[model samples]
Structures are given as C-alpha cells and as structure tokens.
Target: MSDEKYRETIIEQAKKDQSAGKFQSESPGFRSLVKSYVSVVSPDRKNIITEGLTAIYKNKNPQPKTLNLIDYLLGNVKYCKEASDVSYAEFYDSNGEMVASYSNGKWISYGTKAENARESELWGIYNEAWNNAARTSQKNSYVAGTDTTIGLMDISV
Candidate 1:
C-alpha cells in the first residue's frame, strides 16, 4: 500500500480502537500504536506530529544535543585525521576553496554563499556528513534510551 494510504488506515484503526476502548489513554498499547503511526510518517510530517504530541503529552525527557558541523566532522572517521589534537579545524573542497572552519568551538563558513556554514551548501560534503551523523546519533540514542530488557533466562532451566 502507498505510505499515505497506510498512514490513513492506521489513523482510522486508532480512532476505532479509541472509541471501543481497546487501549486506554497513556497506556503502553496506546504509546505503541502512536509509534506505529509515527514510523510511517515522512520526516517533515514527523516533526509536526511530534510537536503536536509534545503539546498533548508534555514529554519531560531532555532533548538530545547534536554537535555542530565542525564539531561533528572533527570526530568523524573521514575528517578526524585532518585536524586531530588541534584547537582548529578547516574543511576544503576538492577545488581547494576553504568551505568552513572550527576554532575554539565556533564555526565559520567562508565565501558569499551563506551567512553561516549550517545555512549553506557551500560547506558541501562536510555539511552532508554532519547531517547524516547527527541523524544516526539521534536514532541510536532514542533506541538506546527506550529499550528495556525484561529478564534474563535461567541457565539451569
């Protein structure tokens, strides 16, 4: 089924479940159902959905912090060797133009393309890398934070 259609189906089912009292509000089943709906949503829509849910649920968890582009790249496998142990780090395109730099926790983007590296694609590969890394980090942290192990098996059994 199309993603939109699947999402609609899940919503309809959720409505039915709610009216029939199949799952109580704030119950584990309700949260699981919400997660199912959220999983199929597109990225932009997910943000809007999350905002609405946050308003309703008033989530109290602290938000995960993402590293800035320069900070992210400095520790990244591909770029780390270039600036290890230095207080400064700079990214350059294949054409030898300076794209961005990190100094004393500040990021500066070169050229007229953008007021900042985060706002400009002129940072190119570095920007993409940082975005991918940040997204992965967020996903990993979410999974790690939410996962629970119920119990261990008895080896004697």
Candidate 2:
C-alpha cells in the first residue's frame, strides 16, 4: 500500500478498534509515539508501522506500557523536586509508602523489592510509571497551590 493510503487505513482501523474495545483512540501523544516506533522499527522490520499502530491502539506491546488516566488517579505517586528528568517513581513496598527521592543520575531504591531486582528492569518500571503519571498530568490542567484536580476544578484555577 502507498504511504498515504496506509496512514488512512491505520486511522480507519484504529477507529474501529476503539469501538470494539480493542484499543484506545489515537491521541496526539499516541500518534507521536507510533511515529517514533515506526522510524526505529521500520529500518529492520516491515509492516511494523501497521502492527505497532494497531498494538498501541489496543494497549499492547511492542508499544510502550503506560497506565491510563484512571489508573494514575488511583495510584499513590510521588514526584521528586530534585529529579530534573524523572516524572515519577513508584516503589512497590511492603509498607506501601513511597518517598520522593532524587537519583542524581545514580540508582537509588526506597524499597526491599527494588533492592533485589536488576537495575535495568527497575529503570524501565520507573520510566513507564513516570510516563503514565506525566501523560495524565499533562492531559489535565493544574495550578500551583491548588489541591483540586481535573473535574474538581472550581473554575478559579
């Protein structure tokens, strides 16, 4: 198929999948995410653009894992003031309390489970959790010194 036709096909199939509960409708971020994957995956892989787009719309990988907005709201999350690049860190702890800490680009763990795991795996988890939180936060409006969120906005922002 031609490039334009392929893109159009993707959009159509994505719409159908959305209605069938197969995946989410494409957001601007989702589109960008697919673009990134297409560039990387297309070099060595064919039909990756089509497959990746379909998988993402279906909330599956080869697409990056990210929690939906509802999950982000229910999660107990902490953001580090010192983290320049990190968005959020979620440690699965026995006590269920997570502390906001800086890495200084070094590996630091706040929990026992994290201590026993591979550093690379931990980094991926941290990044995915961070991305989900960041994505949800980006989609929602926020104002400093305000505790209100999303639908709770009092129109005073």
Candidate 3:
C-alpha cells in the first residue's frame, strides 16, 4: 500500500473509534471497562492467605498453629480463581503440593480427618479464606494505582 493510502485508512479507523466514543488519545484517557486475568505475587494476597490459614489452624485440634508471620508469604502457593460470582482457589505449596483449597464458596482443608473437622462447623474458616482469595484477586493489581486487573484463576495468592 502507498504511504498516502495507508495514512487514509488509519485516519478512518481513528475517526470511527472517536465516533464510537471508544477512543481517547489523551492523558488520563478512559479506563478500559474490561479486565483481563493476570498472575503475579501480590502483597495483599500474602496477608490474606496467612490470615485464613491461621484462622483455620487455630480451630484445628491437637496441632501447632500456622500462625507465624512468614506463613502468609504465599511463596509458591498457586492461588487460582476467576471474576465470576462462582469461583475457587487452590493453594499449592513450594513443591507444587496442594495444602488447602477453597471451592464453590467452601473451604476444603487438607490433612488428617480431625484437622478438617466437620465442614458444617468450619464455615468461619472457609468464609474467611474464600473471601480473601477471591476479593483480592479481582481487585488487586501487580502495580499500585494502575488499570491492570488480575484474574487469580491462574496466579498465586
């Protein structure tokens, strides 16, 4: 294509974008209404993961609590979820082992039977864990004050 013709085509597209109100070639332009899934280590997720883990362990019977400050670091734990109303997350440790998982808005604890306890009685732990995992992923970005939206469906918490 000749340079003149290429310029005309580009100009036409820009005009269409402006007419559709989807183009804003200026600083602080319109933020995208759509958000894509991103995976990254996030501070907010670290705090949440440890909080939920501690809460569940505290109520567990006959075991040391994972209440240490370092426990929530997330490390290599894969925090998975999506933006849908119904989503879930599985926390895989450094060695690619799933330590605990929350699914369908419920917490599924790993370990001995006594550790898991009764699902009916463990709603508190499940709720805390699920909310922390879901909300942060949908809201937090790898950068501060940016348009980047993350879908935890493939990242770590």
Candidate 4:
C-alpha cells in the first residue's frame, strides 16, 4: 500500500481498537499508536511538535516513579529526613524512627502503620522507575547501530 493509504489504515484500525477497548488510555501501546499516527500525519515536523505530544502524554499518564524519595516523603509523611548514606540511604520520620531504607537495589521498610499502609505505593513507584530506567538503558545501548532485542521483560513491563 502507499504511505498515505497505510496511514489511513492505521488510523481506522486505531479508531476501531479504541472503540473496542483493545488498549487502555495512556498505555504504552496507545502511546505508540498515537506517535505513529502523529509521525505519519506530519513527518517533517520539528522535535518541538513531538515534545508537545510528550507533554500531553505525560500529563495524561502521571508516573509516580518520576518522583524521588524526598518528594515521596514530603508529600506523604508528616516529616522525613535522610539518616544515613554510608552503604545505603535511610529515611527517618519526625520521631527519629526508621521509615524506609534503600540498599543494594532493594528497599527495606520498617513495620510501622504508615509504612505498612504505603508499602504498595512505594513498590509501585520503585517498579515504575526501574522499568523506565531499564528501557532507557536499552534504547541507549542500541544507539550505537547495534541490533536490539526486545526482551520479554521489556514487553511485560
């Protein structure tokens, strides 16, 4: 098919898929489809245009993982401060009680009521950050003209 015809086909398929709920809003697949559509619609546009699209996508899909530990602590806890950073980083609450610690690619949470309650939230943030970092690293590695393998972990994430 011609380029224009193929673009039209993609648009029609996307519309049908959207109406059928084939993909959730702000999902990676949805974002990819949108980017493909935008690219074909205006292939010669500058990066600024794509940057706008990125802002829109980011606004629609706010990733908690983008927030650092300090941001998380300040937003959720009464008071927090970094305690130690010799081998690992530790955060303590206002009462000088250990809230959570990060070390060796893992997080340790004290068994406090607040910590317990926010455990899942913390994990979600961590996982999102880890996945994004992994993806960016993979993309960077492929920038040297190497053939890249889209591993199962990337797809699942």
Runs with alpha carbons beyond 4 Å of true place in candidate 2: 24-41, 45-157
Q: Among all windows of ten consecutive residues in candidate 3, which has the lowest summed lDDT?
A: 33-42
Q: TM-score: which is higher, 1 or 2? A: 1
As for TM-score, the candidate ahead, 2 or 4, is 4
Model 1 bad stretches (over 4 Å): 22-29, 40-69, 73-157
Over 4 Å off in model 4, which ranges?
A: 1-110, 147-157
Q: Candidate 4 overall Cα lDDT vs. reference?
A: 0.42
**Tens-place lDDT digits, model 1, residues 1-157:** 5645644544454445444444324345444544444334212333332333332233232331233475333321112222123244444433334555556767665542222332222224323433555566678877766553222233334
| C-alpha lDDT score of every prediction, in listed order | 0.40, 0.38, 0.40, 0.42
Better of 1 and 3 by lDDT: 1
Question: Model 3, 115: alpha-carbon shift in Å?
Answer: 9.6
**lDDT-based ranking, best first?**
4, 1, 3, 2
Candidate 4 C-alpha lDDT tens digits along 1-157: 4546645544444444444445324345444644443343332223322332333344433222254565444322221223322234444443345555546757665544444444433334334544555556567778743533446446678
Candidate whose lDDT is highest: 4
**Candidate 2 residue pairs in backbone clash:** 23-57
Task: In candidate 3, list every pair of residues with a backbone clash.
Answer: 79-156, 81-152, 81-153
